[model samples]
Target: MVASLVIGILFLVLGMALRYWINRRKFYRRSPIGAESFSSYEKSVGIKFIERVGKWIAYALIIFGLLSLWVYSREKNDNEKQTKAVESTR
Candidate 1:
């Protein structure tokens, strides 16, 4: 649970970073004289890669965080059942 939340936060931060990078890139692209690389410019719209992948990763992490909570609940329930069964047997 904790791990997933941490991972989700980390992914969220990365997505935020991508947002910052995109805004900064746009800022720098205001003039043709800027030194932004060709490949970098090509990815401005997330057409090439990187940004899109980051988005997917962020989504996956968020989903994983939610799943982790469900997992914890199921695990707790199973544990309780096992304990009860053991107590009854004894």
Candidate 2:
């Protein structure tokens, strides 16, 4: 449960980072002050590349988070079953 919960939290953080980055890119494109920094940023790292990577990463994180939840629940259920079996045998 702890492992799954940690993984879920990590996934959520990663997904948020990608989303924030994507939003930053969009914001830079529109905001005049961001134009200077964005141009340099674009030159150093292609805007298109970040856009594509960000979207894919965000999607992957979402999937990972869901998987984590599933695993945690499954583990908890198994633990409960085991405890019940032990009690019954006693």
lDDT, candidate 2, at 90: 100
Candidate 2 lDDT over 1-90, as tens digits, reads 789978987897888788888887677667555443554755647866868887888989978987897898899999999999999999
> Which pairs of residues clash in candidate 1, taking residues 3 or more apart in a chain or in different chains?
none
lDDT of each residue in 20-68, candidate 1, tens digit only: 6756655665566764445565565554366557556656655665566
Tell me the TM-score of each prediction against the true structure: 0.46, 0.71
Each model's lDDT: 0.63, 0.81
Off by over 4 Å in 2: 31-45
Best by TM-score: 2
Off by over 4 Å in 1: 1-43, 46-49
Query: Cα RMSD for candidate 1?
Result: 6.2
